[model samples]
Target chain A: MTITTGYIISALLLFGIGMNGLMTCSHQLRKILAVNLMASGVFLILIVTGFGTDGSAIDHVPHAMVLTGIVISVSTTALALTLACRIQQRLNRSADETAEGNDDD
Target chain B: MNGGLTGMKKRKQSMKGKFKRKDWQFATLTSLLIATLVTFLCWAILKEPPGEDLTAEALAPLFVQSGVTSPVTAILLNFRGYDTLLEVMVLFLAGLGIWSQATVDPTNPLVFSSPATHPTKPNFHGPGPELILATLVRILIPLMVLVAGYLTWAGGFQAGGAFQGGALLGGAGILLILAEPQRISTIPPALIRFGIVLGPAIFLLVGVSCFGYGGNFLQYPQPGAGSWLLLIEFGAAISIGITLTTLFVGGRPDPKRLKGTDQP
Candidate 1:
């Protein structure tokens, strides 16, 4: 197979692995990692696709898109992490109260 | 009847051993499905021909018209400026979301004030590491700011741009916080808030100002396009830096909390 084809396959494999992790992983942190992996896989595909095998000039539009995508991805990830933190804190507080109630009993 | 049924079930279970478990069957089925899907996808991707690069020729000449030497920056800030504008808004909205969540339950203490003020990861503890870290930060923060400034300026003709430079500034801000988390808390809240909004506000103002000048939104008049792009980039870099740093800090920083805290 060609080198470009190899890169595409690798990208697809990463995307598949990330999808599987997203579907099956129970932990929220693991899910976030999976999402990032999937995003990187897509980014790789976009950049490689722009570099066509015909030896033509590189397309700058896709590069620009990827740059924008990178920034937006970080922002979304930050928001997701914040939500996860809040949820974890709430869960721990509830668990603590339950333990205290049981102790009193 | 119940005794006979239990005996029959136990005999069947012994015969089957562990091979017929439901969870195992489900796992195997899902694995097979995923394998088949992946195989199909790989085959399809490999079969497709790599198309000709049509966009490069079409966009190359237009690049110079955008008043930037780098084609990527030209496309981002000139040809498709709307997307970047929306992107800045998205970053702003994410910060706003986190800020709103911060105020949801005021009964609970602010994020860093709880007795359990530890982060999820094992943070630096003890005076030795703290002193080393503080010293390193003092050395690196100014250097990072200088690099960030260079990167923003270099973006006009090179691979770097507002995003990369802003990220560097944001990283420096995070490092400062890690070295002394309470230092940021001591800052006036109004200044912090203004810093966070500065990028998007300037970007919007530039776009709207174009309308009054009889140009389309975000369109620069032919001779002065370069200057406008530079102006927008500078404002965006500053705002982006502050927004990213705030996002990393998490929660809307309350001004009242700064009272009685020792200054750095």
Candidate 2:
């Protein structure tokens, strides 16, 4: 019933929606979540593109790629979050120091 | 994330008379983790099995070599081998990147606090049941290790392969981190380094080995299913281990130090 274009559109929508949130969200963690959402959506589309019509599959290449992609995405996300945590720690430290300065003022 | 964060224990000891150490935690992580879980649930509800046929199609010669069935080993070692090779490199790069980013060394045990503040969580409710932590890892690590081994070997015939098997192994490491971080330190740096770099290095070596025979890169002449498959899977195990470990811990778990060890 569904077309490849439709699959693509769904994937794009997922990515776009998540991207909007990632770009706009002030919360650091929310940005990470949004990125994750976008990644999932993209993988979904990749999977859809690789599907066969009735019984035969169109392409196995994409599926294999997606399999690899999923683990890579997960790993990248973990690294990104680690960065977020580090940044958060730095920000918190400066904020505390600034608060002390303002108290003196 | 809700517990065990002490960045400043040493200096705080000097000023302990005035400042109280407190634990701080954001309640939001649990919510985010839950949300991620739900999203995965939805995906599972709608997921399709990735066909072996798909992989077969890819490995089947595109134009000239269209007559024969595409082999999994062929794809891994040939057709899209570039992908696998680069993927291995990515793992290596990630480790190097994280290593470069390390502010401290892994050899140091994470101390109760840093030199500044007392070891206290502002939001620490209580501790996890210590017995549960120890017992859970004791049972789970072995089972997980077994499953990881199975995934690596079973990958040749089943829906799972090197990546899934590798992921399972990586998951075991993460589980160990969660249940008993003390054990994580005992794993040597050399082993970790070797394991993380093994996949790409070995993959490259294999490619070169084939190249020496006057063939293009990764064109292993050994087409027999049993022997070739074993070689490729072994490579997968190494790459999976390296990639997943670095990714799971975001490069490495270089905790804060106890400080006095610098002398010894």
Among these predicted structures, which one has the highest lDDT? 1
Worst 10 residues of 1 chain A by lDDT: A96-105
Shift in Å, residue B33, candidate 2:
30
Tens-digit lDDT string for candidate 1 (B11-130):
988767764565467656766777788789888877877566777888878887898898888988999899998988888888888776652111112243222232333334334337
Determine the backbone clash count of candidate 1: 0
Q: Model 1, A28-61: lDDT tens per residue? A: 9888888888888788888887775666778888
User: What TM-score, to 2 decimals, does candidate 2 have?
Assistant: 0.69
Candidate 2 off by > 4 Å = A1-10, A98-105, B1-77, B103-129, B251-264
Q: What local lDDT score does residue B191 receive in model 2, on the 0 to 100 scale?
A: 78
Off by over 4 Å in 1: A99-105, B1-31, B103-129, B259-264
What's the true lDDT of residue A91 in model 2? 67
